[model samples]
Target: TLSLFYCMVGVVLVTGGSGLVGNGIREALGKHETGEEYDWVFLSSSDCDLRDKQAAVELFERMQPKFVIHCAASVGGLFKNMKNKLTMYQDNMDINRNVLAACHHMKVQKLVSVLTTCIFPDSIEYPFESSQLHDGAPHPSNEGYAYAKRMLEVESRLYREQFGHNFVCAVPSNIYGKYDNFHLEDGHVVPCLIYQAYLAKKSGQTLKVLGSGAPLRQFVYSIDVGLLLIWMLFNYNDEEPLILTSNEEISIGDLAQLIVNAWGGNIEIQTFILPTAFNLKYNAVRFQQS
Candidate 1:
C-alpha cells in the first residue's frame, strides 16, 4: 500500500528530475541527512506527460507523494521564446495547471513551484520585488512564457485561498550550473556561452556572442538555489512567493570575458549585435536572506 511504502516517513517528489534544477536538488539532498526522514522521488518527462491531467493524477496516485517540488516547464533561450511563443505558453500552462490540480486532488502536504525572474515586468524598477509581479507586461520577447509563469503564481494563490493548500512559488534569477542545457541557440545565456566557448576553443576561432552583451543580469548557482529550496520546504509557510537570487550583477560582456578567461586558451571574443527586439536588460534581483 502507499501508506505501507512510506511507513517510516512520507514521500517527497520532485518533477523535472533530470533537468538542471532537478540535478541541483538531487545534489543538495545527497549532502544532507534527510533520507531517513523522507523518501525522495525524482521524476523525468519520460515518466509521464504532465500536460495530460489524467496522466498527472495517475502519477501522483502512483507516487503518493506527501510533498512536491514542481520544476517542470517548457523553457528555452530568448530566441526560442520569441519564435515559439504559442508553444511555450500552451505547454507551460497545461503542465502547470495539470500538476497543480493533481497535487490538490492528492492532498499533497506542500508544493513549491519554481518560477523565473523573467516573469516580472519589462519596464519595472530595479531590484525586482514579488509585489510588482503583475504591475506591467513583461518583455515582448518572452511575454508568452512570462504570462504563463505569472498564471502559475496566480493559480498557486487561488488554490491556497480556496482549498487551503500549501502551494508556494520560488522566483529565482538566471540560473546556471552543471547539467544545464548547452544548446548554443536554445539554451540559457550561461550554458549557451559555455558551449560556444567550447566550440570556439576546439576550432580556434573567435567566439561569437549575441547582442551588445551589455545587459546586466543576476545569476544564481543552481546548487545554492536547491539548498534554499530545501530550507523553504521545511520552514516557509507563507503565501507570498520568495525571490531567491544573488546580490552580484554582471554585464553580459563581462560575463562572456569571464567565461573565455576560464577556458585558459587565447580565444578572442566578438559581439554580434542582434536586432533591438532581441535585446533584454535584466536588473539585479534584490533578496534579503532571513
Candidate 2:
C-alpha cells in the first residue's frame, strides 16, 4: 500500500509548459488551491530538447516526478503540416517515444498524454469514438502529424499491456484561449482569426479569411480542459483514450463574426475560397467523458 506521506509529497511534471495548454493547466492549478499538496514543475523547450532520448531520461531522473502530463509535440497549421511532413512526424515520434520510455523507466504512478481531434481518420463517421481511431487513414494534408499522434496511443496501450504502466491519452477538440499561438500563416484557426481581425480593425480594412469558412469545429476553453486533466490525474486510470471537447459546433465564418463582435463589430469579413481540394470539413462529436 502507498503511504499517505509519500502521496502528499508527490511531484507532478508538465512538459510543453510554455504553450497554450500548459498556461491553462497553470491557471487551473492556481484556481483549485492545491499547490500545497504537490510540487508542480512546468518545462518549456528551453529546459531541454525532449527529442533527445538521453536528455529526456536525464530530465526525468532529476525531477523524479510521481505523475507526468505529456503535452509536448510538434504542431502547426494545415499548410505548414503539408509542407513539413517529415519534420512533424520525426519530431513528434521522438518526443513521445522518449517521454514514455522515461516515464516507464522511472516507474511513474500515472501519465496523461494530450492528443488532437485531427488524428481521427478523415473518412470516418461522425461523433468519433476511441474504438474507431484506426478505422481508416487520416487526411493526406496532415497525415504525417496524425500518424505520429496515433502512434502515441499505440505506445500507451502497448506499455499498459506489456508493463502495466498507468498511461492514458486525452483527445481534445479545437482548444483556444489565452497564450495561444497567433501566427497568421502557421497558427491554428481561432488564434489566427483573432490576429487577422485585430489587424483588419486597426487598418480599417476588410478581413480576408481563407476557405469558404464553412468547416465546423468544436472548441473547448483551455482552462476547462486543464480542470478536467487535473481530475483525470487522480480519478482516471483506464487505457482507453478520453475525449475532451464541447457540445456546440461553430463554423469558421460565424466564429470570425464573433471575434469581430468582441472587437466592436466594425470590420467586414471577406471569404477567400481555396481550391476544392484544399477545403476540408471537420464534423466532430460532442464531448463525452469515459
Candidate 3:
C-alpha cells in the first residue's frame, strides 16, 4: 500500500523540459495561481537520457515526484521522419516505456503524457475522436512515429485497467511556438517556413516550399496547449485522453501567404517534388521594393 503522507504534497516532474511543449508548460505554470503548490522539476535530455531503464529509475527515485508530466519523445519533421523511421520508433518506444514504468513503480499520484494528432488513422472520418485511434493504419509517411505514439496510449490504458493508476494522455494538433525546432531540413512547417522566408529575404532569393500547397492543417500554439495541460492536471481525471486543438484548418498555400505577410514580403509560390533552390534575384528585389 502507498503511504498517505507522501501523497499529500509531492514533487511534480516534467520530462523533456527543454523542448517546445515542455517549455510552454513551464511558462504557463510560472503564471498560474496554484503553481507553487509543489516543487517542479523539469528534466531535459541533458539531465537524464530516459531511453535507458536504469537512468529512468534512478532519476525517478532521486526526484521522488508524486506527479509526473511526461513530454519526452523522439520528434522530427517530415524529412527526418521519412528518412529515419526506425530510429523514431525504437527511441520513442524505449523512452515512453522507461518513464511510465518508473512512474508506476514509484506510485505517482498522476501522470500526464502527450500524444500528437498524427497518431490518428489516415482514412478516419473528420472530427477525430479518441476511439478512432486504432481504426486504421496511419499515413505511410510517418507510420513508425505514429504507431510508437499509439502504443503509448495503449500502455496508459492498460496501466489504468490493471493497476487502476491515474496515468492519462493528452493529444494535441501540430504544436508550434517559441523554442520549436527550426532546422531547414527537419523542422515543422511554421518554423521551417519562417526561417526559409527569412533566408530568402536575406540572400535575395525566392523561398522554396516543398509539395503542392493545398494540404490543410490545424495548428495549436504551444503556450495555449500548456495552459490546457495545467487545467487538465488540476481538473481532468479520466481514462479517456483529451484532444487539445483549436479545430481551425488552414491550407498550406494560405499559411504560406500568411507567413509572407507576417514577414513583410510577397513571394511567388512554385510547387515542386523537392524544394528547389530558386535563386531568383528579381524576386529578392521585388521583396525589397515591397
Give all candidates' CA lDDT scores.
0.85, 0.85, 0.81
Q: What value does the lDDT take at residue 186 in candidate 3? A: 82
Off by over 4 Å in 1: 1-3, 34-36, 276-290
What lDDT tens digits, residue by residue, belong to model 2 across residues 107-166?
999999998877887776676677788898888888889999999999999999999999
**What are the models' TM-scores?**
0.93, 0.91, 0.90
Single out the weakest 10-residue window by summed lDDT for candidate 1. Answer: 276-285
RMSD of every candidate to native, in Å, equals: 2.4, 3.7, 8.6
lDDT of 3 by residue, 1-290 (tens): 22343345578889999999999999988667655788777899999999999999998987888888899999988888888999999999999999999999999989999997778877755665777778988777788898999999999999999999998999887889999999976888899998988887778778777877766777888987888877777767888888877656787778888887788876665556754211100000000100
Per-residue lDDT over 1-290 for candidate 1, one digit per residue giving the tens place of the 0 to 100 score: 77669644789999998998998999988665544389988999999999999999998988888999999998899889999999999999999999999999999999999998778887766665688889998888888899999999999999999999999999878899999999866899999988899899999999998878887777889987887778778878888888887777788889999999999959999988875332223443343344
**Which parts of model 3 are misplaced by more than 4 Å?**
1-9, 273-290
Show the colliding residue pairs in model 2.
none
Better of 1 and 2 by TM-score: 1
| lDDT, model 2 | 0.85
TM accuracy, model 1: 0.93
Best by lDDT: 1
Better of 2 and 3 by lDDT: 2
Model 2 spans > 4 angstroms off: 1-8, 33-36, 275-290
